[model samples]
Target: MLRMAAILILALGAPAAAEPLARELFGAMAKPSAQAPEAIGTYARGCAAGLEELPESGPTWQAMRLSRNRNWGHPEMIRFLKDLSLTARQLGWAGLYVGDIAQPRGGPMTGGHASHQIGLDADIWMLPPSRVNLSRAEREKISSISVRTEDQTSINGNWTRSHHALLKAAASDPRVDRIFVAAAVKVEMCRTAKRADKAWLQKIRPLYGHNTHFHVRLKCPQGSPSCQTQKPTVAQLSNGGDGCDETLQWWVTDYLEELRNPPKRKKPDGPPPKSAKTYVMSDLPRQCAAVLSSR
Candidate 1:
């Protein structure tokens, strides 16, 4: 609950005086598919048209945190999850336990991340699904485990080959742009995996706070011209070396410490404080404005 409260502060409640326009407008949109499922603008600051919801439960996967109503995503993302889960099952692993995809109309959310705004990113719990018969209440009550150690440099003892296999399958998928996991996991993979297969490590970029679940980001699909590309894309990361370079050490040491104890800031000298740099309609690609009011 403390983490959730902090997320609310940063993403939703920071500016206490008035709600951001993008937040207010996007928050009011409750239902999905009021328009076509088109992704517009970049992942961190964008909007989606015609959103689709993953099923509450699938044969090989189940969506969690349903009350947030963030199971919606673009058509490509929904299909990617379905296909990825199938691949996992074929790889002798259980299905995925999916997390937030996007809001009904991808934009600045009430809490959590900024990148899910465009429906191309999804979070899959590192926990392997045990069975296909999980209830919505079970999904809510069950918790994912933290694979990171106290120092944030390695996975806990509970880490298994299945976890590695599941993530590798996701990364190997052509449609996936990159998969974000704990930095320690990257170092472990670099040390243990075969030389030829190490190339896949490039896509498993390390980040803090994903010890419990890994976030998967997809490239903009063909024909989605409005979908903006991100900087230093997955292709760029793979060009020089496997992403398991010195960055892994930086992520665990400096980055992890910073994330745990962000610097304190005084209350706004001018105003209560405003939304993040990317949380406004104008900050997004112009096509996103149409996406916002398309219905």
Candidate 2:
């Protein structure tokens, strides 16, 4: 009886076996092959360590939730937000959204093509105070704020000249990688923002698109072995004359198609080339005084 009782106690105290790490886990989070575990015990230990380092608050943590569908971004995405928030504040913009809480009725998801699932990407509403002509109370309501789907259209109407300035400011910030704005707005911004600051315009252009709401992308944080690297490109201003109306239309169509039908993952045929430098607001020509004065 004594021996049996001792055996039972030992069994009860022992830990249960750990589960294996799925390949999807590594792919989704962009983990490198070397660090991945071969055994279930090692994998669990790694996961626990990784989770421990993740933030408990902020956009990435706020956005995290268990779901049947696969979309949540990696844990490092939280760190990216903290950095972005600080950078954006310096340039005079408000906070970012972890999800599509403020997406206009029929507007794209908050992250655009990048999955908002992990909360690394966010949408910064281009609420430029100069254009809205709203009272202090109204401005407060719009900043770092979210709205229901029903209220999206009304908020979009608020995108004005001041908002454009704010967007330009945000794009010019060194930390920002890309921004998506409405097509008409993009055209208008391309004209003036490029002129106002050539470097900023170049940084923002390739990352620019025609979403009703603005999407902000930041660099992948350190310690995340799985992050994708994008090469920066030189700034390319849209020809102010609207000469590429057909090209714009085709680009939008193609972008939407890719969004709906994302390509399957495959090994590249050659070494990944460096990403071209994007056209941010600062890249615009200084000589275009006429563009800024008109705005």
lDDT of 2: 0.35
Clashes of each: 3, 38
lDDT of 1 by residue, 124-230 (tens): 98777778678778878899888778788677886788778777887888888889888888878777878878777788988767888999999888767788767
Worst 10 residues of 2 by lDDT: 37-46
- The true-versus-predicted C-alpha distance at residue 250 of model 2, in Å, is 6.7
Q: What lDDT score belongs to each candidate, Candidate 1 first?
A: 0.77, 0.35
